[model samples]
Target: MISDHILLTLQVLPILPTLAATNLRQRISAFIHERTYQAPPDGHVKNVIVIGGSFGGYQAVKRLTKTLPTGYRVVLVEKNSHLNYVFAFPRFIVVKGHEQNAFIPYSGISKGALEGIFHHIQDTAMEVTERFVELKSGARLEYEYLVIATGSSSKLPSKVSSTESKYAQQELRGMQDKIRQAGRIAIVGGGAVGVQLVSDIKDFYPEKEVTLIHSRAQLLHSFGPRLRDLITETLTGMGVTLRLNARPDLSSETNTLKFWNGDEEMYDLIIPCTGQQPNSNIISTVSPASISKETSHILVKPTLQVMDDRYPYIFAFGDVAATGGPRMGRAAMFQADIVVDNIQQLIAGSRNLCVYKPKFWFEGAIKLTLGKNRVALYIQQENGQEILVDSNLGHEDGDVKSQWAFFGADAEELETRKI
Candidate 1:
């Protein structure tokens, strides 16, 4: 209906306003930056580099970028593309298809929200020095301050391969496939993971014979006798065969497990949920003197900094660093606050080092699910004693909702602050 020139003008006219608005926004931003972030002749902008992007690493990066003032660069290097919500792992496996919900894209947290200052490297950190970090791809990044939030690796044979997204998912798939072919399931190690695995299997597959073997005399030795007795009673009631003070002598074909009590048993599927080792190799490579060979964790000062006076700029947190306390996720998150605070203080040219005192009440509460719609909550006391608390709720009850909410809330918080 219109001439060619008129049609062209009308189409291009819409784009003009967008360009004008974009230019106006840019001009406003530039003017605001010029007024607020103008550096003096001697003032130099410092850079803060964060290594690792898992649980503790994500928290450290998020808190640093959110709290640190303008004129700072924060670099986050992580090998994984997506941040996994591992706490919900056990429940995800029991269901048919909930694997996607367990993993959140790391890109959800944009750089602009992180103070217009964030760099993400999708590579493993090969080494970390006082001033630079070397990536596995042969790229070296320089930084003013470094935070090591590297967590620990799961134990193998008992642990599913990292190739799988969630440990529970892998276990679920393996169990679904193996249980059909397996006549009996033998789980070694009486830790939380092992006990939880047994519960999940017995709850879902009632016909399957599940036996849990542990080297210790009772379950959860660290939780004290009362709590341990509760766990033993719950597992026994769930139709789980408990092999106490037993060790399995592993063989290739037969897969025979032998206990110290001269008892031998054969298993169709053997899973060992023993322990995990910290990924402290990066710290050890830089400063071996700061780590204890016996504990395999770096000794950290009260300020969450590595105990090396030579390199005051380096800090470590999470499971990789031993803060004279038990290594747990709650502890790591608490330590992340201290790490971020100390980092902020250092950046502001303040020498005031903050001390991190562990709290008994906030140490962390453990909730273990027994097969028969019951869960045990272990509350720790100030005097290092654990008390057993119990709750009864099935899979469809509010307890599951609360459990997912707790894990999802933490995961969402981390994912939102990720850079």
Candidate 2:
């Protein structure tokens, strides 16, 4: 044999080659194995995604996340940074004198603080595909369950301005300034919004002339004759001019409103508390079949799931969804409960889908502040009509405090999940 050093070197060289060959063979085997067995579907995890983060959307996301299991993911995609309380819009216009009270920052609901139960995506949704939603930023989110709670937007006069929330706030401020400067204000539309706004304005500025113009012959025609007469009488007593069956076509410049009616009365300001259109463009793009032909509202099954199988994973609620009942914030919250229940059932692999029954007998309460100490109350009846009730008490009097307490409880629940 050769010397000991030479003999060792030769043995080491042969072992190195053997090790390299073995490693190469293992790599090749793994590659072949990977190719032979395709990767499993990435849709394994159960995900619940909610689009929109306003009142109805926010409540839905909060309830769903609270009710969902630990492993399930809940994603809330919202374009706005804050939640605007639309119900308080009139109050902001009258007392608070600004729209700031309507907006609340959404950071109150943090993901890490909630143990990562929910994810907040701050972006506008562009398209909703069969299994994914494409964001405006080109990011795609895949969801097993989807909730579309996009609400409605106000349709104002062309001169009034656009729907930019900032612009809306500016417009409200302008209106407030005009209210202080002018002696007469005319409000068109006798719906809840119009009536509430007029009530608040008259309550604060009692001396100012407030005229309510309505196309209908009576106030709140939908609520029946007795209640309408009562409300009309109340307004008249409060020095509010009620012009029923008066259709005034509006023409506005920078400051004054000219009515097309024969009177041709010039108003210091004309506020159109007209109707609203559902923000259903995204739904239309995603599931056109799910929307009703007559009303742009989305049609959903009893389970709140979209009627089209293409979006069986998608569900809708709020004013935009046709739930076969009155579309109100309260009703949306009620439907959210059913949505939460059905989503949980789906995740638990249960075939049972819960039906969402509209509470026709549910009487919605209405409170309108007429002046510093005067207010009006209207409660719905079993026959789907609003009846005039007493409204002399403040928050501390009678059931007023209890009513506020209930509202606070629901608000706290909503606040706890803000993000």
Candidate 3:
């Protein structure tokens, strides 16, 4: 009972490990090295603190460590114990036996970036001041420059538990149990997460009744119309009940949902696959004018620096910045390139500053796994058309290897062995 008039904008969007050292002296030397190294007493070294260890923050810290001049220490502050590789969350959360691989150890990143140049702190940021970030642990990390990349949060299972690593694992396992127990599942918000969850759940338990309710007429409203049609077809073909242009009543009970269309449904479980909301409170407090009330993003220039001229040195990106593009992981990585380059130019006393140009379209490339075997990819074509390709990666494809094999992936692990 959805109308075609609500066809509007939707942006589709888009995920480490450790290793052993070669020698004993090198191992000892590296073991003693600090991940979040401090400057010398004489203040010869500059502190480059990057908050958030997700895709963008990790990339920023990695770039700083490899490119920054010597004596400039890179510090990454992440509250989580491990970098949860969420790319496979849609699949891994549904299918069993993949939970162990979902989380990559935060230890042993930046194979050759430099000894003692990069440091990691397992803590959360409570506020941002002009000179430094105040941590929840009552520690102040002073920085010559700061990068905010605290990405948004979503429902658990789709997102790992927000607590510590062990608890996160337990939470994921708990969701697995719930998925197994629930005969009827309702997923709210038909973005990438909701659609993908429908496919994943159907693949895992084909007999279960799974329903996806989207508020927009088009599932991925920002994506090209072609992709939206394809998603609708695939979801229905795979046995998911699709409800378009429907909003759930907030006052409904825990297990029941009443829709805006005057329809009500009862399910054993309901999961909200929400989109990213900027974690901009800390920086917004410091420079209120730098944030936009509309999008909850810290207003930044194209160079990714805060709009407030008084604090141009502070930069924001990823889900936290109003960057005028789809907030994709790759987009954040691209922003890191510009931020790091500009920081380099600033420290080198060079007038040339690199402006950031997003590589992906405003919505980024559309990637969704319809089922264990069916994968769909959407690339933008010229004149506003979209090239849609569907492939079957299959449940047992060899190409899907653990991504931690390469260095500088996942922005270097939080912990690394010395040497």
> In order, what lDDT does every prediction score?
0.68, 0.67, 0.74
TM-score of each: 0.79, 0.76, 0.85
User: What is the Cα root-mean-square deviation between model 3 and the actual structure?
Assistant: 8.4
Which structure is stronger by lDDT: 1 or 2? 1
Per-residue CA lDDT of model 2 for 321-366, tens digit only, reads 8877667666787787678778878777897888987754341445
Q: After superposition, how far is residue 416 of candidate 1 from its true place, in Å?
A: 18
Q: Please give the range of 10 consecutive residues that has the lowest summed lDDT in model 1.
A: 396-405
Using lDDT as the measure, the top candidate is: 3
Itemize residue pairs with steric clashes in candidate 1.
Answer: none
Clashes of each: 0, 3, 17
Candidate 1 global CA lDDT score: 0.68
What's the candidate order when arranged by decreasing lDDT? 3, 1, 2
* lDDT comparison, 2 vs 3, better candidate: 3
lDDT of 3 at 309: 92
Q: Which portions of model 2 show Cα errors greater than 4 Å?
A: 1-46, 97-99, 111-113, 155-171, 251-263, 383-388, 395-419
User: Model 1, 288: alpha-carbon shift in Å?
Assistant: 0.9
Write down the RMSD of candidate 2 (Cα, Å).
22.0
